[model samples]
Target: MRVLRYLVLAGLVATAGTAVAAPVTYKLDPGHTMVLFSWNHFGFSNPTANLGQVDGTLVYDEKDPSKATVEATLPLSGLDTFVPKLDEHLKSSDFFDAAKYPNVTFKSTKVTPAGKGKLKVTGDLTVHGVTKPVTLDVTLNKVGPHPMMKAQTIGFDATATIKRSDFGVGAYVPNVSDEIKIRITTEAHDASAEKK
Candidate 1:
């Protein structure tokens, strides 16, 4: 009985010694992150718009990918389509109503491995005062120290599609193409490294 008790205690000690690594938090590098979206314009051609100055955080653990989390914000007031007038129109009440709802955001609920350095991130996307669930297909571009910045960084490319009407931005709907394709290229610097 003493020998059995000793064995159980030893097993418990061994298990306690094995600690799971905590996820590392990274802050989005605004200078290296971009959010671009495209939609069919009257079926003539696809036009694209860009949202500048994105900010976010990503908590990830490569050893335990399921622990990954993401939160991002995009200011709709910074929307640009190259054409100044069209840019202004997009922010007007007819479209995004940027004055009323200035920012769009996403907070991940689940992170699932999708094979080959890819992840399927399911999250809540809030836009124009509406919140909807959306999934982004993400591929890790690279992870390491940046040569120029000398900071630990991780890069990823993600894509998703959403219907504008679903977010109450349906002014043109069928005419302007309700479906919008979004592509994001992001680089994040380790929060701890940023202090140095």
Candidate 2:
């Protein structure tokens, strides 16, 4: 009963008096969101991969985007490069060692407006048990009506780059690229609907 009441109170805070209320929270739809990363292969071409099951929440205030925040968590063992054998090897102790560290996460501390709907989100990115401050260049794509989903939606694209060595994931180092580039395309479903 208490949980149900709290849920209702949250919904109330999310929607005060608007047809399309500004979302106090946006739940990440993993099916609609993507997490991608790329690294140089032994000083050669860049190898790209899709990390699986990134889930999180986003709190947004359009009128005051500075109040916006995003949090994401990805299972480290779910790393993939389309090759089963390679994926397994990467998850072993030689590389990411998913056994020891099973997840990587990011929690935004601040969202500063950079330009028109663009923001520089400063956050702590934890990787392989190492935490470091990182900055993500985020672009708010759009937020409004969605004819297909029958719900308000928010879209954003973000990018951040970091050195693998800094996070203690340094195995290949100079042989392969130490720099890892992370890209995220978020499609969040706003359930903060109309409030009376």
Candidate 3:
């Protein structure tokens, strides 16, 4: 009976060890979370551009794989294609129409952990009154305390190739690349717990 009791206690301790979770949260470091998009104008030439001001949160469970999720919003008015005159034109009804639909938001419905620190994030992407299924190819670059802010944060690089025309940004299609490559360099920390 003594031996059996010892074995049961050992098993319970092992189970408790696995249940302890690592601190994980990703607060969008707006200064570091860059939303960039690019397309080919004619042939192989790819013109790249970036948008400013993306806000969001990324929650990760290092021990429990099923509990991870992401939520973010990108302002449509912030989209910049590098040309100042063209930028103004883009905000009109012919394109993003910032006056009407001002923001693009994403909320994750599923997160699957792939080996090599990658995530297959399936989520709803809402743009211009249209909500569609979008998946972000997320690679967890690093997860730890921030050197500058001194808070726990996770760094990731994500990409999603989407069609602007699908969201009714259909003005200059065929002439412009139908496939837009969107890239994000994201650093996330917990909003309530982060110092900076």
Candidate 4:
């Protein structure tokens, strides 16, 4: 009886340890997330654009960071260049062709610790109906209760560079610039906590 009791207690302790390391899923807060991009315009200036409508889910486990995964979607129609005409032109067939390929998406393939509060995220990014692998240098901004919403939230800032020509969005490649820089800032709330 004594041996059996010890075995049961050991089993319970092991289960508790697994539970503590389980990953938690967080729902992206569109209001607090922004996807911004910049490209060299005719070797003159680097112009920027932002995607307004973004949504995603992130599963993260601080205890086992390798288990983290993220999937996000951005509507191409929401691209804003701060100029109405330029935004319209970007959505036309000459650029993103938003009428047909309406959304851009990314799904993380691997997450590795790069340093303190930083991660190297490799993912597949689909833009203009072309899919390619990209890596983002990500920094963890914060992870705790949000001051405004009083909810558990996690924030991150990530950046990546991609060549537009590889994605089939190359119009005037050498002139308009083939390389685009993307920066993303996102805050996600714990979906389970939000229900309460």
| Most accurate candidate by lDDT | 4
lDDT of 3 by residue, 7-103 (tens): 9999999986664455356678888878888888768578877777888887787776567888889887677877887778767888778899998
Assess candidate 2 and give its lDDT. 0.84
User: lDDT by residue for model 1 over 1-196, one digit each (tens)?
Assistant: 9999999999988775553244679999889888999999888999999998888899988678878999999998678899999999999999888999999999999999999899999999999999999999999998877899887788999999999899999987798999999999999988987987
- For residues 27-80, write the lDDT of model 2, one tens digit per residue: 787887778989998776887887778888888887789989889899976687
lDDT values for all models: 0.90, 0.84, 0.81, 0.92
Model 3 accuracy (lDDT, Cα): 0.81
| TM-score of candidate 1 against the unseen true structure | 0.88
Candidate 1 error regions (>4 Å) = 1-22
Among all windows of 10 consecutive residues in model 1, the one with the lowest summed lDDT is 15-24
Off-target runs (Cα >4 Å) in candidate 2 are: 1-23, 192-196
Best by TM-score: 4
Candidate 4 TM-score, true structure as reference: 0.88
Model 2's C-alpha root-mean-square deviation from the true structure amounts to 8.0
Q: Residue 151 deviation, candidate 2, in Å?
A: 1.4
The ten-residue window of minimal lDDT in model 2 covers 15-24
